[model samples]
Target: MGPRFFGYRDRVQDELVREGHQVECVDDRPSETVWFKSLAKISYHFTDRIILHYAEDLAERIAKEDYNMVLYLGGMSFCFTHRQFSLIRKSSNARFVAYLWDAFVNCKRFGQCRDLFDDIYSFEVKDCERYDLKLRPLFYSNTYRSIPLGSEGYFDYDACFIGSVHQYTKFKTVSSIVKELEAQGYRVFKYYFMPSRVAELWCKLTHRCYRGQVFQYESLNTTQVVEVYTRSKAVIDSPQNGQNGLTMRTLETLGARRKLITANEDVMHYDFAQYGDVLVWNSDSDGISGFMRSPYECPPESVLDSYSIKTFVQTLLGEAPPYRGYHNDDCCNETEDAS
Candidate 1:
């Protein structure tokens, strides 16, 4: 697996090891040269070459190891071709499984190698229906659970938002919500992050919404994120356009026992939302203040346990049952999704 923005690859590996299984992780895009990394960001052809080489090396290594299963995370289409997948399959008796945390539109390359896996799972319901894969929601790492829930009236801020600026729409929505909250005398903590200065500069130049906005260059570690969540009464989530799956932040907020203010209405269908812990908002909506003031209703322990990392890994490996709360009859007609 490649290095995810939040070190999920490392966390997943750690969980597998804790479950008494030996694990070896190979970087999907392995390289030491700075120039290659820079060029790969701009050139798909160059990145494909790097991925092909890495796949060849990994195939050889897998042939030598007595592995029982090979789990391919998000980067399968970006990393392997049909030929390379065939070579790896021929070289190993291990079961191949894939789990996509992104939508099909974002990682459409998964289509090319879909049949190579014994089983496939996706976080997006649309992707599951379109690709005939199992539907799974993202998980909250144990780190979020470690955060002690603050007592009522002791929160440092009324609300908080800590996420990368992925698009102008998300940036604008978050800004508006923060502005509205602050205007109402609510102290809101905002941590807007951009991956690099170049990306920040490019967005500012291209989008008017980003022109005067400040963004953090480095991302917060899990500890820092948990700290921010711990200090706040609620977390704001602005999902990307066309995304239907719940984001890692949404799950983390639940794990931390914080109220959620989200743009995604699909959350209302979930079992946890039945108690009014989540507030669905839009640019024109009201009642945000009331929702923020409302006492947070904790979901059942079973509901929280269903979305934990342990359950996530177990379900992925077929050692435990998948969470059934994700599926609902009303979910099919929903126009918006989260994350």
Candidate 2:
């Protein structure tokens, strides 16, 4: 009902609930029969109808609740038409806010439907600057807290990467870095999501060593993800092609108290980077070996607290700093329908 489908949303809901907000989650993408998903994938017109139905169903349920806020996390709009969104918007007197996690790729859809939300926030600062959207970077879940059980010895891998091979740049960067690490005799684990059966077979044939690690694109369970994050000495990340900002992987590394080796130069702007908690390097750089050998430096407690899920939730609710530019006084006012 909450963040079950999307882990980041779940973490935000958990933080909001922990802070004493009675939260009611309406899953925008409810589990449906496999036949339903297969049909939705085949026909664009049918997909629209299915999504419209989902939105109407969700709106009806939400209209019954007394929620003071309605936050539409990313991906809901892929299914919702302007008509569906408007119906949901009018369902309650709640302040409507949207936080976009994939503005880099979904910019046009967001731009076309800008007026649907009373206030909009994006993880990419460029979106905020270029589109007048409010700036809000991603945050790490509190569940990544340090374990005092001294369990570091249980893991055999020095570094690990868990993500997809959808983008060519992402796949090339990760594969190159991991291959280099393996050549250097450093144990590394990687999980890549192949887009098709053919792609999976190709990966299995070419990279025989990674045969068991590759899988089809789908969601990985949170417990399994956290287990890998906590066990590894360092986590690896590569930004999307043309991406200039940080992703949840950067936040996850911080949350787990593990060092990060990323291609994201944005990390240099943060305080933790100055203290060597995170290293910004590319596949061609020789610094990774030395960086991997060094013990991870824990960033200051204040820095850690700043990037926590609680802070992100508080800021979204307009109860803390790093505000999202929406005020309670103007929150109830309706904007022009840009549909």
Candidate 3:
């Protein structure tokens, strides 16, 4: 019924609530089922609503609540806005936690929120290096060796993507990636758009710049999305930061026991990758092409042998390794050497 979009905010809110933690989502837009049903379904298991444009009002609201913490999603301006943070600090009584997508690029925008956050969660290791500055490496939970949990070592799905591309770089990057996959004879379908309800209108207006495959693409529901990802042979599960988490697709895909090809090598290195040979790595530009020709298969028993969902949750909530200062000395030494 309102401006709906399926992004990480819903996932974040849903997770917090599932943990029985009270959560207040602050955003300028509303959740329209026509636009964000898949998002709500995948991320939230219960009823949900927007704050009717709680841009800065959330600050005062938080100040009055009895919450345990405040989680700041990546703001609407693309990076964390100073206004949002200021209001959060002004509004809440709980510990301030900032969840950012990219640690490298989006950092400069957190002039106030940076100091206000009690913990920071970044999907990037570069952010881990500065955890004392409020970085929480919670994304490094355990990796699994199996898929479809109950199903033996079999996945019916093929290749898939969970996150989306909206801006200039994102559009270019995602469209190019999909085109690249297509060039290699892979079938790719993406459902992410600006906002679900107004997606058509916005696309029509911005088509001159945000040109990609809109007409050819139609949205899919959450169940269908997870079904496809789990059934596929491989899922494109890495994040570009500012586009973080183990990636909802990563967890859901692995939970489904499908092979994963992701950019989140840091987590893989943290002991999750050992679960199976199903994981595909593509760090360099050319590596992606190689994977296109020879996609990796999802490993079954290995994922179970490596990590579990409980452990994954602990990591997300800051109960695992990758805590601040783990590799600080080495990083500092390396930096000094270069200088």
**Number of the top-ranking candidate, with TM-score as the measure:** 1
Off by over 4 Å in 1: 32-43, 47-49, 75-77, 330-339
The estimated TM-scores of all candidates read: 0.92, 0.79, 0.58
Give the TM-score comparing model 3 with the true structure, all chains together.
Answer: 0.58
Cα lDDT of candidate 3 equals 0.49
lDDT of all predictions: 0.79, 0.69, 0.49
Candidate 1, residues 184-279, lDDT tens digits: the string is 899999999998898899888888878777789878888888888999999999888788688889999989989998888778767788878898
Error of 2 at 171 (Å): 1.8
Error of 1 at 211 (Å): 3.0
lDDT of 3 by residue, 1-339 (tens): 011244456655555567676666655333444445455444422222332234345555666678766555552322224554455566756666555554545445554346666665554455544443334333211222333443334443246665554444445555555556667666665555454535645765765546435532445566666566655566665465355335555655555555566655454543345645334444234655454445355455544323344443344556554332223234554322221
Lowest lDDT sum, 10 consecutive residues, model 2, at: 330-339
The per-candidate count of clashes, in order, stands at: 1, 1, 30
